[model samples]
Target chain A: AQSVTQLDSHVSVSEGTPVLLRCNYSSSYSPSLFWYVQHPNKGLQLLLKYTSAATLVKGINGFEAEFKKSETSFHLTKPSAHMSDAAEYFCVVILSGSARQLTFGSGTQLTVLP
Target chain B: GAGVSQSPRYKVAKRGQDVALRCDPISGHVSLFWYQQALGQGPEFLTYFQNEAQLDKSGLPSDRFFAERPEGSVSTLKIQRTQQEDSAVYLCASSNRDRGDHQPQHFGDGTRLSIL
Candidate 1:
């Protein structure tokens, strides 16, 4: 079975500070990884994805993630956090041979301080 | 529609009542999926369909949960005799291509189902 674990349940950052949300995945085969962001009462929005082509994947809103096979990790990072960046982040994994099923992690809520 | 669309953004049903949630995927999308998201938890895969054919439904919790896509464009997830545990947000998503191509799935604003 494949799954993703988010290390933090909540992370608070000051405006303009760097932000990091950790995620670790377990997969038997090569997997497709993705990052999604959700605002209150809103649908999830795709942030970035790693499909084995690029180790470093850049996404919308100045966010990026690095996929490390050896580490089995795909952590999301932003150099500078803005007020609008406050939302929930989910680390998702699409294991090979699952017929396009997505396993999502318990989200990490981000809080940006002014 | 420009994106996936879900109907009845909010629904309230009594326990033992049957409820149906609708999902309209992006036009021409070949694959559609249904997911269940509990409060404070991540969304879990419930079922999948490929062009009107239900390819995978192993994630459905029980027989009370049913989903269908007749023409491969509009899909519906029906829950019979809903229980309190079944009270969660039902999400629908669609992808441009099949599973092997690794296309990203677009999500809809989920239908929030509350069972009283």
Candidate 2:
């Protein structure tokens, strides 16, 4: 079975500060990792994904994540945070041989302070 | 259409009543999925469909929950005898190809089901 764990349940950052959300995963095989953002009363949007191709993946809205095989982590980061960035972020893992169901992390709620 | 679309953005059902949620995946999408999200929790997979075939449904909570994508383009999730525990947001997603192929899955706005 594959699973993902988000390190923080909530994170608050001042506007213009660097942002980071940590995630760890346990998978029996190579895993496809993804970052998704959800705004209030809205559906989730794909931020970025990591296939076997690259370790550093860039996503929409200046968000990026690096896949670290040794650390068993895929952490999302942004150089500067915007007020609009306040939302719930989730880390998802899909195992290679599983039924293709996404294993989701508990989710990290981000708050941007003015 | 433009993306995965779920109907009746919000629904209220009385206890012991039956309710059905609908989803229309992006045209040409080959894989469709349903998930349930409760308050303060991440979305959990409920079922999956490949084209018109129901492939996996291991995540469904109970036998009272049923899903079908007979024509493949549109899918429906039906809940019988709604209970308070059934109140949650149901999300529908679709991918361009086989999920194992590693394609990104697009999501719908979701239907908020409230049981009273």
* Best candidate (score: lDDT): 1
By TM-score, the best candidate is 2
Q: What is the TM-score of candidate 1?
A: 0.97
lDDT of each: 0.93, 0.93
Q: How many backbone clashes does candidate 2 have?
A: 0
Error of 2 at B84 (Å): 0.8
Residue B68 alpha-carbon offset, candidate 2, angstroms: 0.7
Task: Please state the error at residue A24 of candidate 1 in Å.
Answer: 1.2
Q: Place model 1 in a CAPRI quality band.
A: medium
* Candidates' RMSD to native: 1.1, 1.0
Model 2, residue B37: distance off in Å is 0.3
Whole-model lDDT, candidate 1?
Answer: 0.93
**What TM-score would each prediction reach against the true structure?**
0.97, 0.98
